[model samples]
Target: MSDSNSILFFVLGCIATLALIALIFKHRFFRQQKYLPKRVITPFERKMFLRLKEAFPQYHVLAQVAFSALITSEDYKIRQRFNRKVTDFVLLNASLDVIAIIELDDPSHIGKEQEDAQRDAMLHEAGYRVYRFTQIPTLAQLRKTISG
Candidate 1:
């Protein structure tokens, strides 16, 4: 082969190799990034699910029990005279209308107990229960927690 042709072939080979590497990385990275099924769930929701998956693996079975079992009225918007507007998560058998509000807490909850408390009271007065899980509960735990 002529020197020019050989060099061109080498360049093409390098480009192809780089493309393959990029494809591989993209595949490997996002393959594990699959979130839950609901497309409407926000980034916070997905983060919550991921956290739950990580922290409470034992609850995997429970998490799948039923959406109703864990969250009775997810994203339930409430406009109360208390000047507190909020969404609700009702635990299935908790007997309370809203036993928990699964807030995906990060550094915010560390020193913001007051803020959390205010939110809790808003739901409380509205006749609901509240259980704050700093981290996400695993599917198994979520299943059992809601089911049982």
Candidate 2:
């Protein structure tokens, strides 16, 4: 073979080898990386969750519930609005029917009243009751608020 042809093949061979090594390294890097487990609810939410469970032993108290699980619509736009939104807690009866949507308004909820009202309105329009609290209520208070 001519020197020029031999040199071209050598360069091409080096490029192919480097490309293969790069592909292997990229695959290994991604494979070695993994997602770690995370807490599903915050510390405050955790405390409230326990309280809800204690307060409403007759009903199911679900925390960090996606709105999608509770409601759906035929309109894509309507679905888009709530698909990404999650509720702090959802109370369900023995028949698994949604009784009410509970929202704990911590410091994070400050200045979001308008947005929260809109969300609550949407839930109300869908025939679901919504309860908002700045702090965890006592067991009697919870029963009174929910039952009334």
The most accurate candidate by TM-score is: 2
**What does candidate 1's lDDT look like per residue over 30-127, in tens digits?**
67755667554456656666655454444431221222333234345533233333332333323434333455565656988887787667656656
State the lDDT of candidate 2 residue by residue for 1-148, as single tens digits.
9999999999999999999999999998867647888898889888888888998899998888888888889999999989889999999999999998999999998999999998898888889999999998888998899987
The alpha-carbon lDDT assigned to residue 40 of candidate 2 equals 87
**Each model's C-alpha lDDT?**
0.54, 0.90
lDDT of 1: 0.54
Q: Which segments of candidate 1 are over 4 A away from where they belong?
A: 1-44, 49-85, 88-100
